[model samples]
Target: MEKSVFEYSHYRSYLRMRLESAGRRGSKAQIATEMGVQATYVSQVLQENAHLSLEQAEAANVFLNHTSQESHFFLLLVQKDRAGTKSLRDYFQTQLDEILKTRMVLTERLGKSTQLDEKDRSWYYSSWIPSAIHIATTIPTLRTVGDLAKAMQLSSEKVMETLERLENIGLVRKEGLQFLPGEQQIRIGKDSHYILKHHTNWRLQAMQSLEHENLKELHYSAVVSLSAKDVDKIKDLLLESLKANVEIIKDSKEEELYCLTMDFFSLLKAQK
Candidate 1:
């Protein structure tokens, strides 16, 4: 499962694109020249047809201006890609951001060819949330919980207990009989800061890993205080907003006021 230079090149290319977007500048040609390689070889790396050596990587740092950790991450990606096992892109997508950030630390011991030790397995399981709260808010309204459980074919009590735990952490709120988030909820665990620090690299992986992305439709029976006359216009505005994002795939309407949600890893990369 050792990574080939070709795979390493792909990682370098990916980083190059990301840095470009972040307003950083670099030249692959210049880096190749510095490493005493032909620009064509550099082109192959960018095309993912070649790999990078530690020495070449050092040269890239001079050109791409990546930090030491970043250079290492790029190398890891390439190595993982070369092993021809799990696709790093797929892994990145599937892994929570928190986990992705920290996994690098144990690369030597947990890279593609490595097996999880008993302790590592335990740590991995401990970091995983039983279920993800997919609602717009962290707190689940009773009705929302009922519907979600039915959809997932789980008992309502199971869902409720999970929400209750989230509530205990000050991550959820109850207003009257309805559970909702006190504010916006972005999934973060104790190890999530690393995700923010390496946001772009992880974001691309997230975008790739969301293949089964789905949204659950939810409706509330409560009547709103808003004038009925404004409902049509509000609905129009909502529809417009939804259309603004090409990423929004599924949306459903129900008889009562409703919201959309789905369970997913918020920060699997940093779960622990």
Candidate 2:
């Protein structure tokens, strides 16, 4: 007669169901005290108008004495529900499905491996070299090493060496005097060290742009205080914007290669 925790998609729903089942023997105020939150807060959370913080969710799981899998599933549901964007929610849901499908511990599976190998990952997170090679393939006039060098503003020797590395990595194929991009898509995991390096390189480039008088370049910054919850929402919005920009680039018939970076971080720490 009772719904299993796995049957619920939203953490709030699961918590509400859980509380209802326990309410026959326990009072709402008692449960609220156990969760270290007010009874009205519990009511609001069950009504789907409020969310539980990470610590609160963890406390709830501990109080409920969930099994390892059930706890993992519940935490994932909380994350998905609290996610600031639909894409992130969908991604977490997909991960949940995979966990159910494989019947393995989520932490064990996630700890096993990265999405990319070392070499391709290195090329992916490198500076403009890989982008220059890929973009050059789209332009017929920029096939030769010298052409790529001139277009990328790098020395011919450096361009040739980079092309050779790209070719070795199977990202580009050599056809007589021209280099062609191979049928490969570049994907890097968010946790990769290469991503940090990549971001650092581009941020340096952005910083350098301030010294140049290029009318085509744009840079913007803002310093504003916001709640922790609002910060999460803004991050999701930024990610969606980035995805939209990628889609626009994909749809363009003739595209020029450009780097777009968005950054948001707290400049000051919260006072205790």
Candidate 3:
């Protein structure tokens, strides 16, 4: 797969990706034309002895069909590569980092809409508020900041701030004065550092929700001692249940949004 431009600190590496990127018909000749150099010169540049000048770097961005933010990032990559000293590279790195923090480039061709860098990921997973606001947009009645604040029991200022941050990372979108869910989807994996925090945020909210005397709210926790063979069996059943529920959830109406968290794990140490 062709990696995102922001994933590379070196413009040459990104150009190399552009050269060999699957399904995108490009060649050294075409790339050389874009960079205004001979095909041999394109080879030399990729080999690291030669480097792209600022203007040629812009040309490369054009050749690679970069978005505006991606073009900026590509230019910064070239600048960082041309830096003579560590301090200079570090300086450009800061610019690159800032861009990564705020921009979520859309790789429409790749069909991967969301690529959250570390900073933006941190901001999004920092609290439940941003996530809540993201989900609130999917509700028809909660389109405006005022409506979101009233529905979510948050301040308008807080809603706007979170909405801006979410929009920056492509988690939310605003059309006119109405907010809507962005095309992006956040997927937190088991090994992610944010997984604990992601779970904690909602679990805490789930705890607080217990105060509400509503039959719709559900909570369950159990620690069981079972035969070793049945342990895997129980886990398989839980996994099956989750998969079945997910299928049902997919076709359900978007009337309300909710988080469904499930945890099943060993409470005791292994019998080693």
Residue-pair clashes per prediction, in order, are 13, 0, 0
The global C-alpha lDDT for each of the candidates, from Candidate 1 onward, is: 0.47, 0.72, 0.79
Model 2 misplacement above 4 A: 1-116, 123-127, 270-272
Kindly provide the TM-score of model 3 when superposed on the true structure, using C-alpha atoms.
0.57
User: Lowest summed-lDDT stretch of 10 residues in model 1?
Assistant: 257-266
**Looking at candidate 3, what is the lDDT of residue 203?**
86
State the lDDT of candidate 2 residue by residue for 26-128, as single tens digits. Answer: 6456667877999899889889899888888888765664545567888899999999999999999997897677644632433454343576667666785
Please give the lDDT score for candidate 1.
0.47
lDDT for model 2? 0.72
In model 1, which regions exceed 4 Å deviation? 1-12, 15-26, 84-99, 102-272
What ranking emerges by TM-score with the best candidate at the front? 3, 2, 1
Worst 10 residues of 3 by lDDT: 104-113
Q: Give model 3's clash tally.
A: 0
Q: Which of the predicted structures, 2 or 3, would earn the higher lDDT when compared with the native?
A: 3
lDDT of 1 by residue, 230-262 (tens): 767777776676676324434432223232322
RMSD for each model, in Å, please? Answer: 20.8, 26.0, 15.7
Location of the lowest summed lDDT over 10 successive residues in candidate 2: 106-115
